[model samples]
Target chain A: MTDRWDLSTRLIEPAPDLLVAQPGRIVELAGMAGMGLTRIGYRMLSEASRRSPMAVVDVRGWASPAAAWEAGIDRDNLVIVRCAESSTWGQLVAALCEGVPTVYAEVPSAVRDRDLRRLAALIRARQVRVVLRPLRGELPGGIAHLRIRAVGVVWEGAEVGHGRLTHRRLVLEASGKGAAGMVRQIEVEDAGEDAVHVVSGVVSRASGRAG
Target chain B: MWFPAWSLGRPDAPAEGAVLVVDTKAGVVACSGVDSDVGPGMPRRQAEALCPDATVLIRDIGEEARRFEPVVCQVEELIPRVEVIEPGKLLIPVTGAVKYYGGEPEVVELLQGKMTAAGHDVRLGLADGPFAAEWAARIAEPGTPLVIEDTRRFLSTLDVGTLSGHDDIVSVFRWLGVTTLGSLADLPREAIASRFGAEGLDVHRLAHGQDRVVGPRPIPPELAVEATYEDPLESLDQLAFAAKATAARLMVGLHREGMSPFRVTTELEAADGTVRSRVWRSMSPFSESALADRVWWQARAWVDTGVIPGGVVRIRLDPSDLSGAGRQLGMFEDVMSQVEAERAFARAQAIVGPEAVLQAQPQGGRLPTEQVDWRQWGEPESKPERSTDDPWPGATPSPAPALIPPRPTRFEVEWEGGIPTRVRLGTRWEPVTTWAGPWRLTGRWWRDEESVDRYQIVTSAGAFLCTVGSDGTFLAGIYD
Candidate 1:
């Protein structure tokens, strides 16, 4: 029943109209995933800072799998690691916050049943949205996020208007790895906890509910 | 004895527009067409056409009020209840002014002396009614006051043009065979009203010696706020007071219209006739305190830097193009916090240099890195980082660097199959991942000699790194 609810049928790709606040078409810049996280995440985080002086993180160097609980930061506002080349599929799944609409770069690797449930918990508790790409490094035994995919995004009839959904700053769901989330939907702007609740809960509801 | 009204487009002026000013009482004064400066005392139309290069600055009621505010202040110091028509005109209800300044002519002389010293060509006129006084001022001799003792007799000899209001009045007068105020006066007031409407009745009243204030003119409570300086403001402290007063008055005036200015234009009129103006813009529409703070900061910046001198004779704060309530905040905000980023930036700019503060912008380009220009905050910074994100397609997942040093690094390359087989990473020729090859990089080759070819390789030392140019592959970056 749980697998049916979130059958991993869709590939975790960057949301099309990535700028769009709603969970619309999930697709990534085709070639970007291969470029690795350390190179791109830094620039994106810095760019987001200039857009609206919020926070940024670089989680590609998670060092090892257990770094998540050990990484000493506010659990609520952690940005997920985005270094696809470094992080495994299992590591990325552990990073995602279930149903929370927090932004993540990509699932780390082919996650196990327990790790997937962990990702689902984050989604349910915090509303996480991972901008995962299907591309893998062109290596003999390269681990690709696209290998273990999710169902394609369901846009339904999301109307484009200025509302709660479009105004939320992204909650970066860092799986023990330290990837930073880039919040550019840029609404409901106050830089602390109140802002995050509005971002994840209210904005998620608005985007989730809009026809 | 005429004032030259310059609207720079008159014939004597260049192809560029000139100035035009008209003196009503002088019968005729020199008119310089927008381009022409035809001496003095010329007809308006002729002067305008003669130069054909002048642009006419119409009588700005507000500007006139502003220009004459100092004169009013000076007179207000010497008299009470000064009536202002503005734009080079005023009336001192002299029945009391005469008593205060030792009779009419002497008061007129004192007023004239003050205005003359203040650098104005003043004409004094005395009469019971405001209209009569103004008319007398216009026609009064250069050094003489035009005293219209008998209002009726004095006005009777005046030409019909003096009735000067609407075409309807002129047409009605033509029908009634009344060319002058003298003929108009002969008509009964009741009859003029019944025949030509209330305005004609007004004309008949004006024609008679019975023109009263007629219920104080409906002053728009003030359409704008203006301030005048007693002395040239040579210090930011002095400008602060003037700026505060102007902003407070402006905000109050706009409050009536339920609006505020997001962008305000400050026009600094220099003593030597140079007008320095600039518009200050903000992301969120500001409060009066915030605006004044910005203005003070702007003035401080101007003072700190030598943009404007301490010798600013007059500073006019104009809230032009004000917006309504609830304007949404812009993306690149000017730090709504108390930290005041723009002020700091301005200070940093002034002290170090204007171009000292810079922002990293990503613009569209193909080079491993395309564009990065210096910008200040609150300005929309362009994002060119995406193009550089993954510039190469099949090059073994080589993530490119956002910033490259000034010179292109040289490297020694060895190939396996068609891909770059080996690269001299830091010191020695190291074996490379043969699968991902050919990181095509093309930049200012014509401009510089450092055009590059990149390769993403998993080295024998077990490092996944991006290598560029046969120059020196100094750990462009590592992946897993």
Candidate 2:
């Protein structure tokens, strides 16, 4: 019989290829309200939830569970905390990082610098992946390991009084420590029936940007 | 023992002759001061129709459990280890008590006398096992005690429907012509196991009067968590805080040992050397929050009824009935990490209010908002009111909007030839380049709600899911 019970001989590796941001690091999805930041965030959360339990800190009560389900996140393994106050965002996110492998939180309007440093240290210690969605265009300083900005979007399968929005192509630019300088164009097709496909690849690299 | 009409018999229940009915979302759970036509499990509306003047109140389980604490305390004076099955029902091994009190009749008489003196009407039953004893109690009169000498023979005479908590299995047995416990017990054990699997085997054992023996394993002295206060805790808040910490420590210790306790003893000592303790039982292993809730319930009951003489000085928790940790993780689940996360979530719940921390499960609804059910963290997940299996005709097609505003945001739409040309978004006008129309959504017409036309519009800025109703155009959500 095979030694199935012997865990000491098992090879363990952190899932690096799953997301652009590495474990124990902060990844920011910065954009305006309707610029598809939440869409990208949900996609990342979906991938993260496949590996371990994940949490979402909805500051403005804008995290839609239905959309998240459509985006392929495991509803059973997800916990959504609705917190409107900005002052407690640091403590709440840190608390979530302790239990969940991935903590996807909406950045409040203003975050104190002390909270950022505390969160960064805790993430390193716990090896928890943190994804920050700054929908109102306010970005935290210096702590983010990688920042993916939504530059533009192109809606497909729709025209003047014609078909519905079956799919769309999103343009994302990645920078900071993790990605250096890479631009990726991804196609997010929502073909009804609770199915969504994200075809993504690195399309190009920026010339002057440096980590 | 069983206390009939427990829900309607609370100290704060409505006065007699009021025809009170306690109900939940499902239906009427209990009733009192009413006729047989208004029985439990009947729909609330039908029960109300039967007794027109009845007072209907929602069931408060916590209140029922809290009120039952006094009876539990009364029984504890004679029996050391009383296992409470629910607010109305409890079990205690009578071998030692019977010997101490001289006989079965004497023990029952003593228990009945004590409870009656305390103004509680209870039924006592003495038998070989809990199942038989409970049925005996159910059939016994208020003062009279039911004692069964032969457990198997007594159980054999009862209908198979008497098997509580296994309704589906019992129904199947009834369908298969096994109508009585006698018939079920006569069936081959191996055949029962082959037909019904493990659950059937359990039923077969119960039919033969072989119910599980309530023998709580002796816990290690080191596993007991205790905290002594320098100053006696004067307030309920102080006691609750202490209980939370003590429960957490006990849970951590149990988790480390890869064991969980199904039975726990909560003991509190007063400043005047007065001691009170209660044994709490759970069908599954007790989590940190659950154990803490039990301690709080017991403490509040004692304080509210003036049973505790003075400020409490010490709080201790002793866990028994140890079993392998009941948490069965999935193939890819990391146990240590999951445990750590659960502890962290508990901490987070404390930081924010418990109500603020929520978990979502998919439910049925046409609108995106109604498709998900949100429950507070740590509470058992309830079945959705509507199942997703139903074909909701007017339901929104996937993918759902990423951002649903707490309330719909009104927007001014500029139209050209009945098509939206531009939309006013937060003091700026953005021209809509492409659009999809008017998925007509009708509200529950019986409630007199108006219908609306929902549109999906893609502007230069981003995508918007808006509704155009008689009132005006409102931004329902953003496809961000």
Candidate 3:
């Protein structure tokens, strides 16, 4: 069956390592600041805009232009809307329902439960993917379809003889229906000057794909 | 129209970070895709520190004009006459071409399509005069055209800061709490002239859209078309059917005159002689069908609201601000779609601020951060003075960092014989298994601006880019 989040095209192209959620599906990336959640979001947003015209409603102006550039979002194709107040969930809902293919928002954590429910309902009704990157706190229940929990860097590998921590192995735990109890090994390496490529290794199929 | 960051849109290596373009005499000549806090005329070092991932390039006057040649050439092909305000901005007079094109929107759409195909993206603005047109273009999103229907109302909403070439007048206006053009125009023209002199009056006239070209142009009397109904019309559908022929005839008259109107002032007269009218503006040339649609929508809204005192007996379509003829019906669908996409993006820009949309151009710099420059979309591209061909000594060797923190993250490093034995990535500390370099990248020690002892270290947890500067050891970039 086609995914409900498949309202249109996927924002970030699905990678062997990175799981690109379907349209309208909320994937919660639970990690600390340095765990690279923002990078994943940028990657997804950039890819989505490249495939189709998209917009970003930056609630707190959190989307970095530099990161967005690295993600390869064409400025011509992308529209960025910035709002300061958490009370602006109404605007966020409006944007979600708009015809734009993707609308990524950094929903502030201080937002009340009622607003979140309203936003969730809008997302469900519109059937459009709205990537919400909360700055803090766990994502409220009944919103996220998949949750990727960062388990920190598991191993730092040195270039055989080079002795520099050039390659790193990050441990991420996937929890959901099909992906539940599955542990995946992902590799992140500095691709020189300023590009980060996340290479995903084999999943130890403690379980099959999320049902 | 105003090209916001013209220099950064160069054909060379496209830069894609916060970019600051500077000249020796002017310091920061232009900036694009940067935060508002960073602006023109800022010193180089401070700008870099403020936006650490920013790329700083000296301005190249010769190359900028050289590259701009194609844009000028493309525009010249469409209108025969174009005034180059600067490298990134151009103005084309449409008074003579409107009749040929059928409408202002059509002409702009053609030019935009042609120029874009020719590899020069431009923003278009239509107004009574060059000053307002340029402002409209500047405010318009890149790759889109902004049509000004009411110059006075539009100008009134603009900040006085939009008045270029009158910095002194602007400063004084700020001091007087006169922020918008409307407020400034409210003051007596004589008072402004007596105090600020002829220059002030020039600015005042510009604000009011009464600039040098406003009243000089003469329009033919036969450009307008009207229809009279024998019986009063009570419904919108009937009113629209009656206006259809009139709209078509108006377009034909405009076409015969070798011009296309950008704005149409439609008037409806009721049987009781009560009249209602509204002016509609289109960014691209309006076809007969499109014009009819607009009229239908207008009449429907009015009739639905009971704004008409009685059934409509008369309808008039008056077209003005003509330009060259618009797109032929058989034009490629892809080209039209591209134009439509541009128009949509421009509408989005109206919702979001202008700075949200950005374009990237590459520039020569040693650091990865310095390699690319980002500028607001449709802004004038800045040319870099320093050639990328030059060997940038002491520049960080590639592959560049995947991520450059806006500010260097300070890290505590235990040094052993000048090599980091232990370091921190975030909260956790790990033993340094191996490492490389204490590459001494010391430069501008004379100015006390930057001096660094750079090293690449690998730990059990992750890799770190460690730099020891006057401040302390800090993490600069990440590899993975």
Candidate 4:
């Protein structure tokens, strides 16, 4: 005595988990410079590279490969491209989506709405995940599936002319189709010998998880 | 053949008597009319000190290739197939050309005469393989050809440093007392392979005068892809767009057969019934976008230089020297996905120039910017200038800045009681909430560069990495 609709629902694929980035979606990491946004993007790339190949389209030449290596990214699986011209950004990102499973790109200031739509369609068709970092400006509404903004950052283990910057605590607020109005706080620590990690206990508004 | 002083020998290079040095980001790449003390691979500052009167010029690779095109075209007239190793160096299989021209001497004489008449200094080398021939050309006097009857014997007399491009392996060989090519060749091939892996084996083979030879495979007729235009398009953009699709089709056909081409011949038909064909080569297999890029470069070079009049009718890509598809793929790597990614990267390179598409490799340096070496997408990785294993004192602490500005931007800083209290960003003044360092970094003191004090300052707005120097306080990077 099962419902016919329930039986048919089993045929369709379930929605992807919200904790991690979903395939075929544009995840936007929006924040000003020095607000821990880029570090978060690198962490995502490191995680993505563990499963599949990843790339970074560094539009402003802002990406620090040393920092990315410290963030635990697999260098062999990562490709970093530095692009400056805004005119070619759309075409380049679209081409990247064709091959790479995950792409973290710095968004240029003036991207046409048509290009975003075209990119969104391609993303869905190819099942590629794109993480967009718009430091200069914001993307148009309805383009991004998830948006994570760095609200605050606190540095520890450094004082006037004394200890070096050893650790940071970052608070992020994520809101989108997946986790609407969810806030999370995470701690990033610099372990000695070229290792940086997000140390445990990611306290989410809805549920606490290990990061 | 090798063009002596290739960079300085460019037609647009400075007049003959002037000492010239051509440098790139990696420092001095080529020089001419300078003493041996100021040779290639030396730091520019060091080179400049050695030759005080030398005129330094930045390397313009595109210009070098453009200027070398005529020479390649000239060579093609005498030999149907010629392989260009770089702008200043090329290789030709002399077997067919030598027989047709009666002998190796006749072939060399004809080529030298052709180049000399065209106002170019030329040197030729004849041997069994490219490796021996290149060395022969290097030692050959201008306007003369050097022929080696026994390539192995000739190679045996050379120094171990002749194994260029394998600096790390060569250094190891030098350390092991293998100072000559003869000593390296004497080592068992399997032993070299086991120690240094595939690249070491390659060097050993070269030392033995055995070049890695891949015979050109016969291409299936249906594998060749072509695009025909009804209305004769003349614009470069139109031709490039057409070429992209045609190149993709050729790649698909090759992929279906589990093969990829290391060389391709791009044929273009002009509206005036002129057909131009050029062979483009790559060290690695040509991806779809790479083949397309070569086609674009060829078409643009022809059209802009007026070599091909009224280019419009047809475009064709015929691939050769096909190798197994997964020959370059690493273990556990998904071949299809990796190939697709490379194709996309090459396409991106086409949109932006090749230099813009980069891959980063960690290297030794104190600063974040200097610690990573950025190489072009497909080129073999070069040895790091410095060794990371060496302890770098005064190096920036890790968790390096995420956003490093291409150039540090000047900022206004107000000091209070010998401490930076506030910094002006744009029109707003943000008070420093916390701060660290005045880590004094004196870089390359030998060059008389000023010392700079770097600080990590946190304000209510954000955190910044800034440097205080004689010039001014500048924002160097962001900790984002």
Question: What's the DockQ of model 4?
Answer: 0.35
Q: What is the interface RMSD of each candidate, in Å?
A: 18.3, 6.3, 7.0, 6.3
| Fnat scores for every prediction | 0.03, 0.76, 0.11, 0.70
After aligning candidate 4 to the native by TM-score, how far in Å is the CA of B322 from where it should be? 3.0
lDDT of model 1, residue B387: 49
Q: Which candidate's TM-score is highest?
A: 2
* Candidate with better lDDT, 3 vs 4: 4
The TM-scores of all predictions, comma-separated, are 0.30, 0.84, 0.47, 0.82
Q: Pick the candidate with the highest lDDT.
A: 2
- Candidates, ranked, DockQ: 2, 4, 3, 1
> Per-residue alpha-carbon lDDT of model 2 for B306-402, expressed as tens digits?
6676888889999867853344456787766766777777777877878888887888887777888888887766556679999988776666888
- Angstrom error of the Cα, residue B440, model 3: value is 3.6
The 10-residue segment of model 3 chain A with minimum total lDDT is A1-10
Instruction: State the displacement of the C-alpha of residue B220, model 1, in Å, after optimal TM-score superposition.
Output: 16
lDDT of candidate 4 over B66-182, digit per residue (tens): 677788899999997887666678888889998899998899999899988988877888888878998999888988889898998999999999887678899999999999999
Residue by residue across B1-480, what tens digits does model 1's lDDT show? 112232222234345435555542221233333343465456555665675655543333233333444556577788765543323455566777777668776887787777678766667877766556667777887666677778888777776677544555787677767887788888787887888765666667777856532332222435346665656677766776566556666665655555556556666665565665545544335556556655565555455455565456666666544532323334544323212223323333333332323334333344322333334323333333344465543322212232233333444566545455666645666665332434456555776756555444444332233445545553333331
- With candidate 2 superimposed using the best TM-score fit, by how many Å does residue A117's alpha carbon deviate from the native? 2.3
CA lDDT of each prediction against the hidden true structure: 0.42, 0.76, 0.61, 0.75
